[model samples]
Target: MAFNRTRWAALAATVVLAACGGGGGDIVPSPRVPFTSLVSFGDSLSDVGTYKVGTVAAAGGGKFTVNSASARIWTELLASDIKVPASCPAQTGLLPNVPGFTGAPVTNTPACTNYAQGSARVSNVFAPSSATLQAAPFNQVNIGLTAVPVTQQIAAHLAKTGGSFNGSELVTVMAGGNDTFMNINGVSAAAGGGAAAAGAAVAAGWPTATQQAVAAGGAAAVNAAATAAVTAMGQAGAELAGLVKTQILAKGAKYVVVVNLPDVSQTPFALAADAQTRALVNQMVTTFNSQLAAGLAGTATTVVQVDVYARGRDQTANPSRYGLSNVTTPACSTTSPANPLQGSSLACTTASTIPGDTSGFLYADSVHPTPLGHQLQNQFVKEQLAAAGWY
Candidate 1:
């Protein structure tokens, strides 16, 4: 399938990023939009806590692998800008936490207003923009649940009064994991006893299936769904980019950055059940990315895709180096039932928890990043942001 760059270009999207195919894969962070603020949109990875106490699941607020410093990804990007075209050291609430260095946070959206919410889907909550009369998720700021997809999130943001942002102010998107998980779990349910079989395998538990549809070919089912998901996400990316360009970039948002999907096959959660399954997961992930690249094809917009998966793709080979603790069971210990599995780490504690740590590598439970895991992503995001000139 020849990649259709024509359509992508038709949308005025432009990717300044270079191919990551060769050499030792040097870190490439993109230049930040030199804007006053970075209004984010998406799920847990980007969610600051829009859904925190709203309770689709009633879970706590954003506590994933935050560096604990004010330097969360967004914050860090804005932190040390002695060289940024013409900006002050990102004001309070700007970017995220700063690392190793802790102090009062300088904010980009200091009004306590950044669109990001932990665990939020692109379209979760149908959250209204009035701010005063928001949805359950918006009230607290969890961003998770709402069990929505990325496309919807974009629309919802557009619906908000202040949600409409432009040029540089809207920085990036880090979403779509839950969509994949939901797809995977749906496939598992199709195979009778699939849930129980998967459940019984590791000490930690797998997500309960909401559907009973199985992949026509077992693991193949997951592969098919993955392909569909990638396709859907790609289409969503293009469409959302359309909104970004017209609504934000054209008006002034300047740049719209997005974090690419990582290697799905590499996740311990998928691999633990079956080695073959793992390989399939990885393969589909790669295949899906190809489709995604095409979807993001030729727009004049600066579209940079980061290989976040590569960072964790070969974890078995080098988990320790990336700060990954590489555990087998889903972060949950069979012996300790009291520990409520949180994010991807499989560990139980909330704050003390970091992603990729063996403590919860298996059971951080949320089908997504444990705060520690997010730390790993933060590293990838920062590096890519630099590569994309977001620094």
Candidate 2:
């Protein structure tokens, strides 16, 4: 799935042509596109709660941000601004292996259209908290995320909509964070020399050879694993862009807003990693973003690209400018016994935050954004959409 330089260069050219409107067709202006529905697809960042049942629901936990009736992720906030009905999860379920949490069978809500789920990757079926990866030797504490990749999320939407969009829906996509995470985990396992752990990481679609290479321990093997993981990340980005063009746009979606991956290396999650690992994670994020931008450049008219990476970096560099008081510390309490998913923003509430005013904090957990952080993202997306004349 790796893309060579020539292919990317050609794709970049397509972006230029498309941005210019393919030979500058007649300058015809029309009324703003009427968006009656806000359709969304991606991971936890945009998730409106695909796992808001059982213990998670009882704990008032669902979306990645602080869980409360009033808490709104960026997508939900955007839906409000667009004058559409409040978005709800297209599906809901939780099949965790842990006790005390009652597992809910997967249920579909045809009326809702937000397809984003926590832990979803771009195209990979296996992801963090997924049943397959949480089983046996890995035995990750089950949070019960379905982790249905964005590719299938789009398919589910198409199937429910009679195989095509109505062209009036405002679609937003934000994924690949989990893909980058899986790659990082793969690299760690391969380098740590744990065969079982490496095998489990391979379930996320890193080549099985990575596990074998780990067994035959050496710096060269570890480097090979890192290279393969990064290459796969770029491929995942390209795959997402291809899905957007072929599955979404080709199926009649007129307004597609694709939010690129943010720099996860800047998140609190990376603070625990060594310098080398953090650098590797940064490389993976940039690589994914680059491939995604190149792949979607050709459809500039219909696709709006939101540069979240740049925004995140800016927020990190100058937190005060963004009204953020703390960019490095997570607002949520990662050490709460009452919280079933300790350290996860999913279980975080106003009562569970670190002491003092957390309203200005940028993160809710190691990886998810706080409400204010989501607001910034919401504002950023609206700005992008307005600039593209698609809002």
Candidate 3:
């Protein structure tokens, strides 16, 4: 769904007084299952140091997006709270088949617990190479640093765990955000081609009013963009559902928490775009989440879906409830005018911030969350784990 700023602002103002003390209570450990480990697989949101060790992101005096030891991400906090051993995994090698891209020429270590990578996606393993690896804008790492998609990350974990879970591991999976992002980026790459493709199909007797409107550009190709994104997300969600079923649940995983894609339409990256572009991005995220939710429905596995999307939207819509002051702009400073959140987190210390302070800002950069944002995210996931009886 598109972001309704006026409506959310009204809701925020209306609930200001009522929500003063309505925030959820502290997270309490569950007694049902004494989960001993937190095995995570996802994107940068859950990554520990895959990017730092594998890619050039950390080469230019830039820290990995999730590398705040003092203020770690939700997964790190969850690991610490649940007492899971921390490990960092890195896969540095030449992409199987990319021109002029040398390998990192490094070996693997087995001490890594968090297999998540910064540019990982749900379907990257199935594909030859990820969009992040192939796309020029993302190929900053001259020595091709491959992103271990969730699929491959699980494979990496399974290689270590031998495709078997002891039922004591608290598996955390948060993917599909990059999947949705790549699909949205696909729309931009195609430009008006979506409209052209829809018009061609209509000309070939595929009669649909939506296609007709697409030809007229009445909806600015959003209909086509949404459809494309939904199809991609549906496929990704299906693969994710299958993986969770066979690789995780069937292998004796008892407590699995999968975080849904957040309302990225409200991220600084989305806000930097025009209103229509923001709406399209929002539509892509919502469609991805909807597909993922549907794929995870009616499963007997003890899989909990954390509604991070709703939680993030609520935090932005009602910042007062979360003690947030700036939910729109990023705390990091970007020199690029086109992408304001491109500022390096390593360089965005409190001294370098636009306001010289990041007290209540929700985001650290264009997309990633700040320490406070990560804390809020951890709280949400903790509540879900408590509700699911997974300690």
lDDT of each: 0.39, 0.74, 0.58
lDDT score, candidate 2, position 277: 76
Ranking by TM-score: 2, 3, 1
TM-score of 3: 0.76
- What's the TM-score of each model vs. the native? 0.58, 0.89, 0.76
Worst 10 residues of 2 by lDDT: 13-22
Better of 1 and 3 by lDDT: 3
Clashing pairs in 2: none
Q: How many steric clashes between backbone atoms does each model show?
A: 103, 0, 0
Compose the digit string of candidate 3's lDDT tens values, residues 300-328: 35898888777777887798888788887
lDDT of 1 by residue, 298-328 (tens): 7434655666556554443566654555433
Model 2 misplacement above 4 A: 1-31, 134-141
Candidate 2, residue 286: the lDDT equals 87
Who is ahead in lDDT, 1 or 2?
Answer: 2
The order of the candidates by lDDT, greatest first, is 2, 3, 1
